[model samples]
Target chain A: MDYVLELQDVSKTYGHGRTAVKANDRVNLQIQPGEIVLIMGPSGSGKTTLLSMAGLLLSTSSGIICVLGEQIDHASASHRAHMRLKTLGFVFQSYNLMESLTAIENVELVMNMAGVRGSRAKERARELLAMLGLGERLDHKPADLSGGEKQRVAIARALANDPPLILADEPTGNLDSKTGQEVMELLCCGLGRDQGRSIVIVTHDHRLRSIADRVLWLEDGQLSETDGNYLPEMT
Target chain B: MFKLAWRNLLHERARLIISVGGVALAVMLILLMAGIFAGSEEHAVAYIKRQPADLWLMQDGVENLHMSSSLLPPQVVEDVRGIAGVYQAVGLLYSTGAVDLGETEVYSYIFAVEKGAPFGGPWDLMEGAGSPGIDEVILDSDLAARYGLGLGDTVDLLGKQLRIAGLSEGTFGIATSITFVNKQTLAGLMGVPPDAASYVLIRPESDADRVQVADRLKEAIPEANLMTREAFVASDQEMIRQMGADVIRAMNSVAYVVGLLVIALTVYTATVERAREYGVLKAIGADTALLMRVVAAQAFISSGFGFLVGIPLAYGIGALITTLLPEMLIVIEPDNLLGQVPVLLAITAAASLLPLGRIIRLDPMTVFKG
Candidate 1:
């Protein structure tokens, strides 16, 4: 199978000697194109660390991380940034949008960073926001939007660059249950099934398991696949 | 990037106004100080510059017309006129005297000009005759309006009654009000011999080289100090600058420091406030240079608006000074205003440094957290 992301025995350690903390230990994972993978774990169980390593945001102490067929473990910072821009998208829990910019502008900012400019960038931004059911709220700033609308804007921003792999870290954590389900439905059904983009979500919500093609459980710096019966209260 | 910078500034309107207002006030202060200095220098040399003489001859020890007194033998004027390049030579007598205006005694500098000569007389005759007869005086219009004196009005100078024969424009220096009279009258009033004068004014022939004529005249009258009109004007301005350059420099230093601090604090606070947004940008693939451009754009925009507000404010202040202090001259030239452009740009550039460091070191990982 064609893999969008593959982590081969990746381990990350913080600090030195006796004080060293192992965040990720020999983690091996793979997500195929058009697949949705959910990673669940208790707090401080290296769920975010695994996502960070897979996204090329954090370096691994040992082993290799490949995204979109490129081994990024030994890449320079600038080269990693280029790979991130060209091959990956990110959705955070807080809906990180520039407060000064409107919804469409926030979406367009990512495109701008990718060297797209003028009316073409604006058109793409409008198309993305409208596709996410935010057509009427295009001109509204983040402060003026509800939690659901803000998450939608963040999703629109992540999809601005059209990267193959979407790394979402608790994207629906801050929303109400209804809004969180709606956001997950938009991601799994709209982006995965329709656009054929691979998704890796590090979430604590048990309800999200129904939409995942496979569920991965993380415990004490180790990752393992499990059936939905092993769910825990990770809050 | 530019739009982001502009929107970020506008997001905090109150802070934006304060930052721009601070820079505007600084610019206004610096311009005002420079304008006042230039005006004073121009005023000090007004009378000398208006004269038609190419060369001025004084006693060998005298360098300026304000504080020093020079007495030349009357034969020197005739001897200078005998030179090949000399067109006309006239003797002038300068003395300080007080004019009694009934309730006030106004100090005046008496300029005694030879009758019918072009060298040492008022050229801008606003009203009445250019040449004042014996026991007559030509007053600057500014001086006349101040004292309510007009043509045909008589005033007491040196205990002698003299009639106001003419009024000239722009003859009032910063510290001196000049009054022109016949040479014989002033010589008689001071009890000096009619054959003696304070300085000799010489006009070179239209076809003659002024430097060569001045050199030849310098050789002829070795006992006198000879200078061209430009040299004398420069010397007078230099003397006046020496009196106030220190004060102007101090004021300029204060203004620049204040400007720098205002810009630094505002831009730094703004950058720190937006640190999270900058981190998100970095996480999303923005380079440090791109981030710095945004901060620099903020500084430049603030300075541009400040300059827009400052230039008009400086002109308004100059107008107010002119209205409140009629005797004071505040000249705002275009060059003086344009000269501040580079200074403002430098200040804005320097101000961006404090914020640029914060942006460069900001951790992009912070954007992942709530």
Candidate 2:
């Protein structure tokens, strides 16, 4: 019953009055430890907004967000940053690796921010890169790496601090079908199952459903759990 | 943070070179101007500084040697010597005359001193005799080399042939070349009384209080102005600085502005190009201070490299100018180079402000979107 992340009646709106746009409307969700949760929706369905709120990257108009059993909906920016450093990790669709840094450096950047440095941080970063199958490319910058390799480096970076939860927004969105499947397998089987860490992935790629312990459908800013048999029609 | 900043700078090699080169050029310009200014001041007062006098007594209302005409009564020298603290007093005769080189005339300031006097004559002798005798002259080596004159060569000064007795080093000013002759000979040529002189040089006793001696001299001789060695040097340098203060100030301002723009534009562009990366960093929990540190590190590295490159380049340029124009004095002092460090650092820090603002206001949500 211990959840890694929880959201209660979260709603986020932009602007005000008649011109206000609701990005997320009254969304509630929770992910237990060691669970793999998948959120699938059409374009403009507020899937990204919901993920942003859960990651403590954006303030919610009205809601309660808890990460690692600490209420953080009203946390200060600095406090939220600290919690993110201590408990949460992020994987972006674009990989978002610092182009100036090598693979090992990108992975070590987070650890450095968390006060880990020198030989220990370097050793851990190398190990993570090698584990992610990027050992030979450790010194190569992002420009020299392929899309799949970049995403792998991003995943290694997200896991650098060993946070309890990983919030991935379309981790495989930029890769080919085969590479996407491979990355998905790595995230689910390699990370979620083998490492016993909770993962929340927001993606439009329904092919990823087989790896999910629970599938949720988001439509017009609302989320609902469903059995694996249901498939939303592709627009 | 420093590693990140260094990597970011090295990531774009072309930008790094251009930015560093720009700063280097600015530094070179500022240093060159300062060196030339300092050189000019030094040259203007070289003769005054070389004198062994601790005090200079001139006619009242005469401010400096170069711009003023001081004709003191020759009796002032004996009067100053009679003082209790007076160690030695020598009279000098200063005038301007032209040396006819057959094809062209070289204008020079003529300094006439008593033969074998303690001061007011050339100290650095490259060749021949140390002090000029009657009808003999000492010319600056730079002037001698330029006109192909040597020791024992005779030159026409004020229509009188005077043999060159010695060649002194580094005694040439931009507008005036100093030539020394016997005081009695110069007085006869100018038709002034041999007992009258331009100024009197005085050396105080070793144990004497210079201020008290100066006060006593002021009281004993109310018609003349008396100044200590340090006071006279400062007055001469201050006069020279004021002459070019407007131009030097304008050039320094331009150099600083150019340096600021170069650094600001390069850093701002680099930051803008990496804005998304910065957002990603913010999203991953980099605080504002850390990000600022990264920027400050970049500025410092750039400035440090620029300074390292600029100093030698300035000196090289100064050497080149001296070779090309022997009359131009470009003296590089250690203090001049050291004085520019703070200004360069300030410009670099100010330049980083442009990029700092861009990074601080960056929204972390942008990384999630695009």
Interface RMSD of each: 1.2, 0.9
Off by over 4 Å in 2: A16-19, B60-63, B78-89, B95-110, B114-119, B123-169, B179-192, B202-231, B242-247
lDDT, candidate 1, residue A42? 92
DockQ for every prediction shown: 0.56, 0.68
Best candidate, lDDT: 2
- lDDT string for model 1 (B1-370, tens) is 9888998999889989988998999889888889888877787677788888888999898888876778888788888889889998888888888878676776777888878877688868899988889899988787778878889998888898999999988767555667888788999998887767788888889999987898899889999999888888888788878878899889888988888888889999999999999988877777788889999998889888988898899999988987776556778789978888998889899999988779878887886787
Candidate 1: clashing pairs of residues: none
TM-score of chain B of 1: 0.83
Writing each residue's lDDT as its tens digit, candidate 2 over A187-232 gives: 6788666788999999888888899999998888888888857868
**Fnat for each model:** 0.47, 0.69
Clashing pairs in 2: none
Which run of 10 residues does model 2 chain B get worst, by summed lDDT? B99-108
**Top model number, TM-score:** 2
TM-score each candidate.
Answer: 0.85, 0.87
Candidate 2: lDDT of A25?
Answer: 88
